[model samples]
Target: MARVSQEHLDARRRQILNGAALCFARNGFHATSMQDVLKEVDLSAGAVYRYFSGKEELIGAIVAEVLETVRDVQECAARESPPPLPDVLIPRVLAQLREVKPGTLGNGEWVFPRLMIQVWTETLRNDELSALMTAGYVKVRAAWANLVESYKVAGLMPEDVDADAMARTMIALAQGFAAQVAVFGAASPEVLRDGLRALMSMGEPRVRP
Candidate 1:
């Protein structure tokens, strides 16, 4: 018997992951079963099980993949001369998401963004998933905070601005945008950028005399 090449093994794993992503995106994590993934990938039960033990493991793998992609985007942005502000950075991250995954349902809905929302919900009940998500968020938030420091160094933002708070705000903004896109299926990245810019442009609040 010939041994399988590493490339062949990697490709098989990717195939299983892609199929699982589609199934979860269409029917959600809870509703999607291992059998659904097997049918989607046109692989035998043994073949799929070889890569993933079950649906939970598959969901964890997919979530980990998405989180890794997000971290890569943040790290790339952080390496820039003066990292982009939330307006530019958030949309850039979203664009990269479109580029990397590029998987859409028949109705033209993006796959990963919708899947992310589902994963967020799943994390609440699953401690392992919740821990994974929390760790991912912490790293992403640290990257954003570093970007905020870059803005301060570049004189784009005030020196006194709290980096951690600003990071949380940016994360919230991005997550809210993803939620909008997932639920309404019509959120505009341009509008998100414009809104962030407008918020940034606001003058200090004043009390009426």
Candidate 2:
């Protein structure tokens, strides 16, 4: 078969991805079917298959899209603000996190956090999904490292702060925190804000006793 034009391919792929995200959000990833996505996009099953071979690939695309949004937000935050990096970064990160808040019942909170946890859990059982999640994590961490590095270059951070390590630490905290809130619901945004403010402040010089 002839390959479709790149622009047409991308546009059609995006349509499927958007529909997949909505389906995954409403019904957890495991519960959503390719047929449901086809209906969501007003496409027939064959049309959906043309864009993506299967549901897993569609989910991968949706996750990639979310990761891209995170990268873009972090990038813009780095450029548009003078940072304590955490100050600028947290608001953007938290804004995304807020989508999953228990009270809001927003689509983002329901679909994304739940689907992400599902993906992470599935990674242990499935290698392809594991690889996709790992790649997504690495990309997100790299975006964060660049953001943290901006603070170091500005002298806002202590010279000793390890940008790469700090980036991983940030991702770890978010992953753990999301799991925590999803499970136990102990830490809310206010708790995270105050805690992160203290953690981020470590770079600041301490007063002499």
lDDT of 2 by residue, 43-111 (tens): 888888886899878867766766777777677766754754564465457567444222222522444
lDDT of 2: 0.69
Residue 25's lDDT within candidate 2 is: 55
lDDT of each: 0.85, 0.69
Tell me the tens digit of each residue's lDDT in model 1 across 1-209: 99999999999998899888888989898898888889999999999889899988988888777777878887888788877778898998888777666678889888877887889889989999999888988888888888888888888889999999998988888888888888888667898999989988999889999
What are the TM-scores, per candidate, against the unseen true structure? 0.89, 0.71
Top candidate on TM-score is 1
User: How many clashing residue pairs, candidate 2?
Assistant: 2
lDDT of 1 at 12: 96
Q: Deviation in angstroms for 143 in model 2?
A: 2.5
